[model samples]
Target: MYGVNTYADTNFASITLDNDVFVGKDNGYTNGLYFSLYNVGVGLRPNFWVSPLLWTMPRGYAENRINVHSIGQTLTTAEDITQANPPEGSLPYSGLLKYTNTHIVVGSRFTDWVSTSVGIVGPAAKGKQTQTEFHALIGAEKPMGWDTQLKNEFVFGFSRGRAIRVLASRSDTMDLLAGGQLSVGTISSGVNAAIMLRLGQNLRDSYPTVSLASSRASNPIAVNNSWFVYAGVSANYVFNQIFTDGNTFRDSRSIDYDHNYNTFMTGITYTIGRDSSLSFAYLSSFSDDDTEYSRQTERLNRFGTLTLVWEF
Candidate 1:
């Protein structure tokens, strides 16, 4: 089990400062704040659930993802802000800007080397009701060579689904994610390395995903509790706009510029009792166009993550 520590790395929760696409209720005025924000998620992972039917029958998971951002100005009420438009860079950050999501998934072993999972997602923000997501995945993992301490084997797997939204980023809600990760040690304890390529024919084109930033959310099948300090990098050739004003995929015209970017991430985790653990990570983005750059120099574009997890 694990969670991201946003304050530790400001870049982890940066919000988009788009001139348009604010409060879902009123796009003309934006509640989207500066890039610095925080995100926290908690979930219970797959535990042995079905043994009678097929031995390694079922493993289920449930989680809630939350993003917290600073809204602007004390005097600028929601009604007051609707009348005037803030300039491109200056926003009236007043209260807390937030996005909340809940997700659940269940998986079962199909064979000694393969398994499958299915799940649903529900997201809500500022009283806005968004669409729910349904997804299913199939995968396999097995040991490589025979070494005692390095007894753990290399793992290879792939998944495909529709509406698989990894992060709150609107641009990230792709039709599928088709990549995997590798651990030098065992899954629980190890120096890990991973790469994921985002693929999609359709974009959800929602507010937070497209409006605030272009970065994708956490990758699927996260590292287990045994992992300590680990670092990884990511690069993507997004066919879609990394950031947009409103419509999502079509919000911006077809352009090849600033479509490719990279991310560098590292984090440490600590275990709690026998079933739970907490973790923190620092992530940075390298791109010509990213939400990382903010007019509020006081607010560093530092990125961070905190997550908490458990098993029943």
Candidate 2:
């Protein structure tokens, strides 16, 4: 007999020519458009204390932007590029880039201690490349001692083609994420926090090779493989009834730093009404080194989001 939803504030920013990341001198406009949606359908049953629930969230965005510069050039074909030898000489180049992603999930809870979910991630399209993913998860919350709640969850997935291959092709690709969280004190009244950790692996295929002799062999260059670990903590607060709490702060966003890696995010949310809310968050990417490959570097890009909700 209830429903909820939200949308965050839109943002626009200019890319300064003095930005340190660019090789030479460059200038352009960079912007991002993001949105999210969630819906839940409940069915009452005579024998159950809680109704059977079906929930789904479809969220994604498209970024239409460009970077014009005098520092980079385009390779006409894949043959012109090499893993060991990248393009040299400063040549000006510019083009349009676009990307989009969607996720459909379903699940139900038995009693209040256990729940399960399974979902298929549609293909994520970027320019001429596309990728797909699938995932399954199960979690439980059990009372431990007098005031603590023990929470645990496990998830697994399989991906193929350019989607999984793209990240695997990177020198710092880490695949697979596994972790759990634990909390103490009441969850509805807020004032609780939990820590989590995740580990990843990079599965890179071998490059083409040729045999020089009966016992000697030569192999062509390929991308590098790597392993990574991530850790973080989060908490929430409520000033009204748990479900109808509009003055509560919460975190409800996912963060992924391309190429099989995880991110740690810390943020707060404030609900303005039954159909309105606002949130501000800071996320940091954790990696093993500052330099991964020659073409990319590990630099922290900070983000702040203000969200508003409307329900029907």
Candidate 3:
């Protein structure tokens, strides 16, 4: 048996300032905090051919609190005042919240040409306002020739609102994923690429929104009929018994919540001796919303990650 654990904490802050020849003071500032915990465990077969089983768990929390002030009076929904000159007032809004998640997964490979895995995920606490989700997935691949390969996968899952009643509203929503890949040149050292697509949906609930109306209610909106596409490329090199591979990456993990979008990533790996190696990767997302009110239309958000691994 093998096990590992890690923890991390990070903070971000920003400020902006403007000075005009004939205007009131103009400046703004914002700040945020993030914390995380991660853990993993594994068991291996002595022969290294029967395969191994691994499990992983991670948890994170983030909060954004901001305040804005202007030398001029800004019109609130309650104000009907017109202004030819800067108004004399300040308007500020701030928010604070925390979230927790729990995950359990089991995976194994049967041979060099085929593999499969599945998992269950949900929140650990009750009375918490968060979506509880469950997922199951399986995948397989086979060598098509000396220089090419084919693969396919399928995923089905469901997400529930804050209460059990919301979960029972449906038999459990469904999702699907399928894909394939191909390579050119030497089977052991060359270039390769793959494309994958995903489709899924979620149930409706009492979500929040900002509108001119004083009250909001839950409505039956179409849940499902969303689709996503991902593509990536990689290069591999081998010298004697040592080898290395690097690849551009892509993913659509958050497409269901943020609307259809795409992410790009790149990574590198080096093999040492015959049965062990290390690798690192980075990923980022891009906007694809067509509507003016979508979050991606207002601001661009990006993320970066690093990973290391050893195999035997």
Candidate 4:
């Protein structure tokens, strides 16, 4: 049976920041910030609303369970934000503020996760103010299209996934992990799979996969002696995406949602001490031909992720 402290290494608080600035571009998933708490049940009770979701999944004898809670905001913008009304078929300005709770079960070589979220979309998410003020501070052009951003609406999401360590070096200095995830909800519906290779010290203490979305749970490393570099590739087939599909229950600026995407990510992680670590990764995404929506599909989507985690 799993012990109460089976996941003590993951009892942490983290903040993640993502932006295109690191890649020298400034549109399409432009910015995001998130704060998260992991292994909440270790020191505090899980949120009451997340209890029912946990009840649905029975625990296994060899697995230990934990709760993760996260809150975040993300912004997406048209290619040209200087225009009060972006060109026809261009990506629309959109914002999301969401809170998510995840149930995780960890075994010796495999981990499973289920998550749900609720969020507000459109002007209520403060996309306009945040971007405009940020641009001014950076001496960049003020964005001018928030007036046409997605309308106010509530969105919900659910996701499930699992990761497995497919191979490991006899010396425990390297490992390979394969993972797949499915998501369904008003925010987006998609399936994605990825494989990652990690090489460095204390590979066993590192998180298995890199998240496709920066606003979601990301790579978390435990312990002060761990350091590694990892690279991975993932393919996604998105059936629906609110940022492109627009408002779920109302008429709003919309575009033909891109259906396919391939992404590559590489990064390095270093633990600063028993309680803290830093991670930085670069991601580049490519999509197959879709509608001529401002020609966005032909361009590469690039961004950088920076994360800081501290264990209690």
Q: Against the true structure, whose lDDT is highest?
A: 4
lDDT of 2 by residue, 197-219 (tens): 32332222111000000000111
Residues 1-312 of candidate 1 have per-residue lDDT tens digits of: 322221121113322232221112212122222332433343422222211223322233222232333222100012123223333433221212222221122111010111121111111121111100100121211111101101111211111111223332354333222222211111111111223232331222111121112222221212223333445555543332111111122221111233345556554544566444454555554665445232121121224444443333
Give lDDT tens digits, candidate 4, residues 1-312: 012334443567788888888888888788988898766333334456455455544355334566678888989998888899898777889999999887666555776666888999989999899999999998999989899999999999878777778898988788898888888899989899988888887665454323323235455443446788888888878788898888888999888645787878888888885668788888887656545642454232467878888777
- Model 3, span 14-71: residue lDDT tens: 1111111012211111111222222222221112211221111111211111111101
TM-score of 4: 0.89
> Best-fitting candidate, measured by TM-score?
4
Looking at model 4, residue 227 earns an lDDT score of: 80
- Model 4: worst 10 consecutive residues (lDDT sum): 1-10
TM values, all candidates: 0.33, 0.28, 0.23, 0.89
Query: Which window of 10 residues has the lowest lDDT sum in candidate 3?
Result: 207-216
Ranked by TM-score from best down, the candidates are 4, 1, 2, 3
Clashes of each: 35, 3, 2, 0
Query: So what's the TM-score on candidate 2?
Result: 0.28
Model 2 residue runs over 4 Å out of place are 1-30, 43-262, 292-301
Runs in model 1 with CA error above 4 Å? 1-84, 88-124, 127-225, 241-245, 248-257, 288-302
In angstroms, the error of model 1 at 128 is 9.6
